[model samples]
Target: MLMGLLWASAAAAEAPSMPGHPEGPMAISSRSMTVKNLDHRIIFDRDVVVKKGDMDLQADRVEVILTAPPNEAAGHALSALPGAGGAMLAEDNVERIEANGRVKVVQGGKTATADQAVYHNADETIVLTGRPETWEDGYRIQGSRITILLKEQRSVVEESRVVIYPDEGSASGGP
Candidate 1:
C-alpha cells in the first residue's frame, strides 16, 4: 500500500511537467506533443500553433528561454522547472518559443517561412533561414537564402531574384 501511494504521489507531482504531457507543445509531432516550460506560468508547445492577438506562430518544436533583467526586483524573477534548463531559445536568451521541421511566423501583416526558426526574448525578435520568405506591408520577399533581421525589423535575402507582382492597371515596360 505504501509503495502504491508513493507512486501515485510521484505521478501527481509530475503530471504538469513537460515530459509528463509529451502531449504539450514541446514534443508535439502531429502524433506526440510536449510542452516546454518557461517561468512556470509560460509554457510553449512543440509542433504547435499559437495565436497572440494579431500574430501567429507555428512550428514543429518549441522551447522556452528567458532572462530576468538584472535591475529588476527579485520578486519578478522567473523560474522554470528544475532540470529543464539549457535549451537554446535563440541566438541568445530566448523564452517560451517553438521551432522544428518548418517554422512560420506572421506578425502585423508580415509572414515569414523557414525550415528552422528561433525566437529571442532579450531582443524581441525571431531569426529564421533555410530558404526563408517574408511578405508584408505591400512587399513580398523570397529567397533561396534569407535572414530575418530582427533588430532592423526587416528581412535580408541573398542570391535571390525578386519579382514584384505587378498590380492591375500597371503598364508593362515596352519591349
Candidate 2:
C-alpha cells in the first residue's frame, strides 16, 4: 500500500534521488484503513503514522489520492506493470497525499509541524498550513504557511519568524 506512494521517485531516479526516497519500503499504521477503490483513494484514520527511510510522518488522518480510474485496483498493484521501473503508472497511482490534524514530519535532523500537510507527487512539493513551523539544527522558523519544493530545492515561508542560533566559534568571536 505504501510502496505506491513514492515509487516513481525511486524508479526514475537515474541522476540522483529525491528527498524521502522510496528506496526501500514504507511502514504505515493507523487505527484503521479504508480502501475506496471507486474513489481511487486510501484513508488512514486516527493516530496515523508513516515512516519511510529517515522520514517519519504523524497525523490524525491521512488520505492518499490516486490518479487511477475507478476500475483501477489497490494502488500497489500498479507497481508491477512493465515500463519505466515496472510501469510509471506506479507513480500516477498516488497522485497526492493529504494529512490533517496535528500533522508532523521528521526527517533526519529536520522537523516540521502543522495542522495540515499536502504532498503533490507531480510537483514534488509539500505544503503546510495552519501555523506551520519547521526546525533544523539550531534554526527554527514558524509561519502562517510553508511551501517546500523538493524538485526546485527551495522553501518559502509566509509571515515567518525565524531564529538562527549563532555558531559556537562565531558566537565566541573566533577568527
Question: For candidate 1, lDDT tens digit of each residue in 83-160?
Answer: 432111111233434365577765443456777666544444444567666543333445565543343434445555
Runs with alpha carbons beyond 4 Å of true place in candidate 1: 1-47, 68-98, 136-139, 168-175
| Clash number by candidate, in order | 18, 0
Q: How close is candidate 2 to the true structure, as a TM-score?
A: 0.72
Q: Tens digits of per-residue lDDT for model 2 on 1-175?
A: 2211111111111213225455545555777776677888777788888766667788999887788742464535333222221121244557888899998777655567789988888877777898887655555667787776666545666777765566522212111
Residue pairs in collision within model 2: none
Model 1 CA RMSD to the hidden true structure, in angstroms? 18.1
List the candidate 2 regions with Cα displacement exceeding 4 Å.
1-22, 69-92, 167-175
lDDT of each: 0.39, 0.60
Identify the candidate with maximal TM-score.
2
Candidate 2 lDDT score relative to the true structure: 0.60
RMSD of every candidate to native, in Å, equals 18.1, 9.8
